[model samples]
Target: MLGFIDSADSHLMSTRSCGACSLHSSHRHALEEIRKVPISKRQILCLIALAYGNFCVAACVSLQAPFFPAECDNKGVSSQVYGLIFGIYELVILTASPIFGKMFAYVSPNFFLESGLFLAGITTVLFGILDRIADSLQFTVLAFSLRIFEGAGAAAFLTSCYTIMPLEFPDHISFLFALLETFFGLGLIVGPTVGGALFEVGGYITPFAVLGTCMILGSLVSIILLPKSGGVTQSKSPSVFAFLCDIGTLLDVLTIAGCLNLIGFNAATLEHHLRQFNLSPTKIGSIFIITGSVYALTNPLWGKLGEYKFDARWMSILGTAINIVGLLFMGPADFLPIEPQLWLVIVSLIIVGIGMAAKQVSAYIACLNDTINRRGYPNETSTYALVSATNFSSCSAGAFLGPSVGGYLLGTIGYRASTQVILGFEILTLILLVLYKLCGS
Candidate 1:
């Protein structure tokens, strides 16, 4: 069992990206708590459960572009009504994450995770049914109600993944997050491909139903694997920051958090731009394929790089730059003569793909190490949760803004102008980094 506990500590759900910085006193206390508990199968179950739930979330997300409009039209809804729907969903996630984070320290993570998966599947199933009912433009009420449950379930599953992975394997925390993040990326890539195929064969109903089924299966796997996680210590909130004894951990985590948000902004805007180009479902799917291939192929390399050789900050920065360039190219891809612009867009996406892979892995690795060094969290699991959620909070926020602005820019000036806006955000992010360094030093 300990051998399943990889010489690498992090699991399919962890995300630390650093090493050997020194554990904080609080981390020492957490590790001590873990040592006192004997390992059991329950801990593994917890991890499997969360991973399955996250996979479900990704499945639904991957199919959105294909299904959402059709689902809405099945009810006589107009295209004019789409923006608020997406916005409301984003709003729910953005508002719900921190609350869920705070809740993780108090509630049973397993219970929270299970309840979330249960609701996510249930509400999604309902979303399918609701689409069939389509009466009037109570769109806000109809759309947001489902989004509330989706957001709640999503936040819960995410928080639990981080919380459980570390406790499941305490000493080898870094590699643990590496595996977790890698699988997470892999799932995100595949979910869409599957969803796209379902869209062609079965339309909107298929993705929703398949997603629900996936959640159900995930629920069962979780029940079996979670018992292995019985070794977990109760979630604790230590005062490493209040005492300021964990600067490296804190800074590294925050820096990565910012970069993660930027990735979301870039990706979200890029997607909307792709749509503006009137790309076919097959073409869009192909782009996802390209992005996923790049991500999946490179993830192992990034992990290997981080093991002993990679400079995480450099990785994060370079990732951000590549994403910016990709986004900028997308603008021209939209309008320019169609031949070179298309190739340019594809190539630019490749760059974005590489950056996203490198950025997330390195940042996560760095965060894991900081948590371990500063707090001595044998798993650095909880800190990973907080940091990841913080990053995603930025992610959800940027995604929300990205679409609205991207849409407006596309409508008013076009994809080229919108791409410029995305570039501006990247520059601003770089400026933010400089400011952070000045303050930190």
Candidate 2:
């Protein structure tokens, strides 16, 4: 499912051992790393600053849902038309990812960031204006045009952040990634909660205006705080296909990396599907926050786990298996004749949340190990963009397909049967893990 890691090369870590490898490896690694590499407090702040900026933009993405309803209603717009506009926004980005990813090697990232923000602001203001008018195909088209600009803008910003972190902070890499994800968790927690409040307090335009100002502000912050990235100045590289066709030591790195990405996305799909059960958005958000917060809290442990001899694949399988079992229990606890106890649902969510945390940490650490073993330093730029793109695309496909799949399973077979689908997928993942071991042997 993940395109960057060449699947064929992931087969080499055959003689694995030490599931009990020390858990303090990340802490130890960081301290020893300090002896070799030193940096000021200001540098660390800059990295956090980049992470903070990225999450602010991402949080605003979901804010549109709450904002759109009021804006559309004020203009006498039907919900269906607004829904269409929102759905089409994904399509625009879907088309743009490959085009941007391919040409990414040649483009100047800073220029890309500036251009994206400029278009985003212009288009977003137009969106607010469109909200004040009656429905017209003309307005619909204009709205979509703006969303495309925003997508391009957001994508560039995200990828650039990935590129920048490796350059700015090289020593404390594991902790750095963990902190990045922690901020991502915070954004998920804060976005809807804050967005919901913004919509309630000030009309629809208030949130958009707020988001526009933040995006502009983030751009300014990025310009001042992030030094020019320390990676290759620019690659006059050949097209992406040629790069893909040529491979050497990096192949194994790519292989495990792809596996890591595939599992991550598949897990995200499960999360989205779990929330689709007629739950209130607040409840859904609550569940995510619980999962995200706890996951962020305990997840740094895997940095130590990654340094061990055990292949990260098994950790993924184990975590996925736990996740599936939790879903199995959670689904039936919701729909089966057994009296619905809220505790069961809560417990189930906690279980799945921990499972997701382990899965993400293991997969990424394995990818990091591979990256470090090869590059002498992590290729944070390439790894971040490739993994994010791969995992997100996979999860997007699954999430888009999940409703219909689950609906059919739930509607025709029943809720119990629908939940069993996760059961089957988890089993498949385990089998794949075994297959990976055998192939490596």
- RMSD over all Cα atoms, model 2: 7.7
- Residue-by-residue lDDT tens digits, candidate 2, 136-253: 6666677767776766666566555555565566665545654565555566566555655665667556666776676677667766765554223542332334323422212322
lDDT of each: 0.56, 0.50
Model 1 vs. true fold: TM:
0.72
Give one digit per residue, the lDDT tens place, for model 1 in 1-441.
Answer: 001011123322323333333321232233444465544555545555655666576666544554465455556654435544544555676777557666665566766666767777777766655555556566547776886777677666666666666656665354445455555655566665776677677756676787776776776666556643332344665444442355544444444443334333333344455665677655665666566567667756765666657666556666667777776675564445544356777887688668767766666555555555545565544554554444455456554565445445545665566566666766665555445545742
Please give the lDDT score for candidate 1: 0.56
TM-score of each: 0.72, 0.64
Residue 385 in model 2: lDDT: 41
Candidate 2's C-alpha runs over 4 A off are 1-27, 31-49, 64-107, 117-147, 170-175, 203-205, 228-284, 302-311, 333-335, 338-345, 365-424, 435-441
